[model samples]
Target chain A: MEKAQEIIFAGFGGQGILSMGQTLAYSAMIENKEVSWMPSYGPEMRGGTANCIVIVSKSKISSPIVSKFDSAIVLNQPSLDKFEHAVKPGGLIIYEESSIITPPKRTDIECIGIPAMKEAQKLDKKQVANMIILGAFLKKRPIVKIENILSALKKVLPERHHHLIPLNEQALEVGRKFVQ
Target chain B: MGDNESKNEPRLMKGNEALAEAAIRAGIHAYFGYPITPQSEILEYFTLEMPKRGGVVLQAESELAAINMVYGAAGAGARVMTSSSSPGISLMQEGISYIAAAELPCLIVNINRGGPGLGTIQPSQSDYWQAVKGGGHGDYHLIVLAPSSVQEMADFVFEAFRLAEKYQNPAFILADGALGQMMEKVVLPEEGSLPYTVHNWATSGMGKRKQRNIITSLHMEPEKMEEVNLHLQKKYKEIQKEVRFESILTEDADILLVAYGLGARICQKVVELGREKDIKIGLLRPITLYPFPKTEIAKLASRVQHTIVVEMNAGQMVEDVALAINGKCPVSSVGRMGGMISSPEEVLHYVETMILKHFVSA
Candidate 1:
């Protein structure tokens, strides 16, 4: 496995992109790894597009800002178009085929079009599309254990949101199965 | 010192532990501070630890009350101190002026945060003018120490108290959020250094003093007020000679970066990156914003072609740098307002494009 990886999540405002980045970063920190999660949204957080960068590494990261990303996950068409060329060559690009109509234009990168939203709808939770994407990310780059990710989600999410945890886990399982 | 030198001295500790340790070492007995900030730790440390070592830590209701408490404590000739952040310090200005007017000895610490309003819980160095120009109403000056590192933060608390006693005036430690949050290795002071005596003028409960000593600033006569102001002005002039500090990498450089508090640390990285790129850049980190380090900066002005002042605010400290250099060096300012920190890369880019490129062309 790589010693350091930079992952970016880009999507529409309501797509839980920031939460997904935070969960991944928190999971890495739980495993005693250095991680930095910075979200990008000002007025964009209200209704416009939103994105976040999560860097998980063994050594301390020099700069939190990234000029190029190791992995890019797009949940919307605009996000896909915006970040396609920015993904590093031979890196992975996971796009939700149900929401993002156009695929990435980068030929050198591995593009995996997972129908994450469709899979979440099957689980009767449209909001868990982010979880599905997260599960795919974990399968692609298993830097942290599945148990750690679940525990991290439980710790971060409020008690009222706990009931939805198992369903989100199911969505992740569906994503992992599809990707495998 | 020998016992403390051996086996890591048994000292009670807290977030405010550094201040108490420094206070005891500086021989301070009377502590008058209201709880605020990152500074609540200091108050808690004193409350629990001060009594064990035969000291007084009074938690006042408000910052105004706290500063007034210090004034009273100092009046009684006890080594006195108080602390608060920007908003709380604003409330203490009236009492601070009284202490200044009376020429009493006391130390104050301001752990700064983002402001102009009730800002978020993040670090900022936006209180440059408020601190240097005497935040309280008066024709008075304060001995302001701007500490950039954690070790300096702990050490300056003691230094501020010492300077206060030495000059018979108020001293301030202007610290920001980063220093408060950052954990660094700190050596505890020895135990026997706790109790130090104050001057004969301090009212120790009126025991064997000529009549009862009156600590008042209510001399309504114009001549007396003028005389008081003149005496303060003379003392301030003397303090200018005692204004001591440190500057890193400012000699024979093309671009000079002027920053204080947390911003200075980031500027250090910026200077290092510029040096790697073969750009002659240095930093003038103001350890004391007041006394403004004008002479040191004026000397650097002859050598450095340009200077850039980076701060967490819009443009507070840059004005001081521009004034200090007397326009000999073209000074520009870059900052991020509203609880955001200016990134090192952002500052480096500004230095390269604004200062370095311009100087090279000239």
Candidate 2:
């Protein structure tokens, strides 16, 4: 609560990058924590890398647009290129190993690779790959409880897609396997 | 965490959706808006919900049609609103002038995007001149409200309508794409909880009225136009008391920062970063962009060593701050053009390397 978690999520447009940030913000809001979720918008999003920033804090958040990040969840190589230096020294970077060819070059920060895309391919719903990555991130830093995330998943997932909730929860648990 | 009180519950919602929900709760009778990026959610939300709530939601063919619809609905004693982004709002300028001249009450929301023409759908404050100074035409002003947060985006819906009807003038909510697209937790008001008044001057069909109410902005005679202009000027002066601003850490500040809307949110971080470096910096945020808190700014100008105005555009509001300070303090501005926003570190760099070295003493 003393220090806010400023996080950036970057991936291709189909990688569910924006929704991952939104889900965390929704969970944070559920816990009465101050939350702000901002997405990288405009014409560049057309097949380009889509990204978002999510900040969760106890105190009121001042600026939602920030340069540095306490953590990053990057799903592709281009994202690694853009945000590898963005994470604060000694902070965390959870990257998808399957999509990225070159790993992060930074030695000061903690970089963990979760083969999230590969893991999601095993699941019935491949789109829950982000949730798997989220689960791995939570294993490293449990900012929000899994139960709260499940509740947030209900809100983030449309009603017709509600059937995927349990599978997504399983994917989250699967994500913890890569890190631990 | 299990507070369980509905009133205390905060909903995480996008700024654009929050604006739409607030309008429904604020008891608007109609919504006339075309679809545009970053602002399309407003029209979509209204279309799905407004009709169910016994209100009309019409996606007009164009922004011009939307604004004219707003004028017609407001004249018919209906609380109405229309929304658009920069280019779309530019199309409605003439109708806005007509509504202003007719002294009709309505809400016009512009989620400003970067533009001179068909610019990117990115956030910008370039429309400040169009919003506060006069986007329309001749001798008329709209009560302009610029909000920084998602909560304020919702809250200002009620506030803008209140001010519009109170003064019998059109009101504008000048927001940027960042504020429109971002999601934040908001404590929402109840549905139709806010009250609004229907005025006798509105032509609500004269069934039992002694006099027929006619709504028109046209005046052929020069003297008649002058008389109406005099009345409008007096109303503008009276509305000056409605000016709103927020001061953060200014009481003991050495360097003052002036910004509005989302720029103010960024300056808040500038204040925090400056304080970390033992810089006595404060931020003065203007909420009412049109009323232009000149008196409050002038008062703060006397004590601070120097003032810096920050905005998204190339120093639009800075000129107003300079005029407000009136040579009492040295005023300079930091601005980002197009859709690029000012980062806090870049501002701190400017402050430490440029501003502190010249203006404020260590």
- Which stretches in model 2 have alpha-carbon errors above 4 Å? A44-46, B1-8
Could you tell me how far off, in angstroms, the CA of residue B245 lies in candidate 2 after the best superposition?
A: 0.7
lDDT of 1 at A112: 89
TM-score of each: 0.67, 0.97
* Interface RMSD per candidate: 9.6, 3.4
Residue-level lDDT for B58 in candidate 2: 97
In model 1, what is the error at residue B255, expressed in angstroms? Answer: 0.5
Q: lDDT tens string, model 2, B1-362?
A: 11233653788888999999899888999999999986999999998887677799999999999999999999998999999999999999999999999999999999999888998889999999999877988989999999999999999999998899899999999999999999999987776677777688889998899999999989999999999999999999999999999999999999999999889999999999999988999999999998999999999999999999999999999889999999999999998978999888888888888889987866
Per-residue lDDT of model 1, residues A1-180, tens digit only = 355798889989988887788778767766877675655533465457988777788865434446468999898888888888888788999989888666776789889888887888888889898888888878987878878888778755777898888887787787787676
**lDDT over C-alpha atoms for residue B153 of model 1:** 67
lDDT of 2 by residue, A111-151 (tens): 99998888898885778899999999999988999899999
Return the TM-score for candidate 1, rounded to 2 decimals. Answer: 0.67
